[model samples]
Target: MASERILSKVAEEQKKHALNVAMATTAAAEAAVAAAQAAAEVVRLTGAAESCQRFRKFDPNLAAIRIQSAYRGHLVSPS
Candidate 1:
């Protein structure tokens, strides 16, 4: 039956189209995940850099204050 043959062909084409659509969707999802991971990595690196900068700025000031406090304590505490 010619009609049956045509129907089978149409079904095969439909299956191929469906598979193509699924592959495209999977590719898009993978790309989105990769982009998000890259962005997260950038944010993590930036935060680390900022924390290091803050510690570098704070350490010397903290040391100076501690020295000053020790000197004052030595003068004020009666032995």
Candidate 2:
């Protein structure tokens, strides 16, 4: 029957549409995951850079103090 054939055709089209929608959803999920990973990497690297900067700022002061202490030790020691 023609009605049966039409119903079959409609069912096939619906199936294809559903598959397309599912594929699109999967792609969107993958893109979101990748973006989240990238953001996390940026945060980690920024934290590391800030920590290095803090240590760099401390290192020069520490070196100067060590140098001054060494000079004082030399002055106190006998010739």
Candidate 3:
């Protein structure tokens, strides 16, 4: 009687604790994934910036040349 009631109460408390722990674990995992994504983005941006700087060091006028060529082509193209 009384023991059964106590057992039922204990089971309910255990279930609540398990649920809270699971929720906390899920939140932590989500935070970790977000942090990883942010780190990856930082790395990607850094790589892009470095590549641009390297390209400029090698040939700074390459992009300007391409743009001029495109403009000349456009000018010659019949409209």
CA-lDDT, candidates in order: 0.68, 0.68, 0.71
TM-score of each: 0.62, 0.64, 0.63
Clash pairs for candidate 2: none
lDDT of 1 by residue, 1-79 (tens): 9999999999999999999999999999976865665556556655655566766475645434544555455456663
lDDT of 1: 0.68
Between candidates 2 and 3, the TM-score winner: 2
Which parts of model 2 are misplaced by more than 4 Å?
54-79
Candidate 3 lDDT over 1-79, as tens digits, reads 9999999999999999999999999999976865665556556655655567877777767555555555555456664
Per-model C-alpha RMSD? 20.1, 20.7, 15.4
User: Which candidate comes out best when scored by lDDT?
Assistant: 3
Ranking by TM-score: 2, 3, 1
* Candidate 2 worst ten-residue window by lDDT: 62-71
lDDT, model 2: 0.68
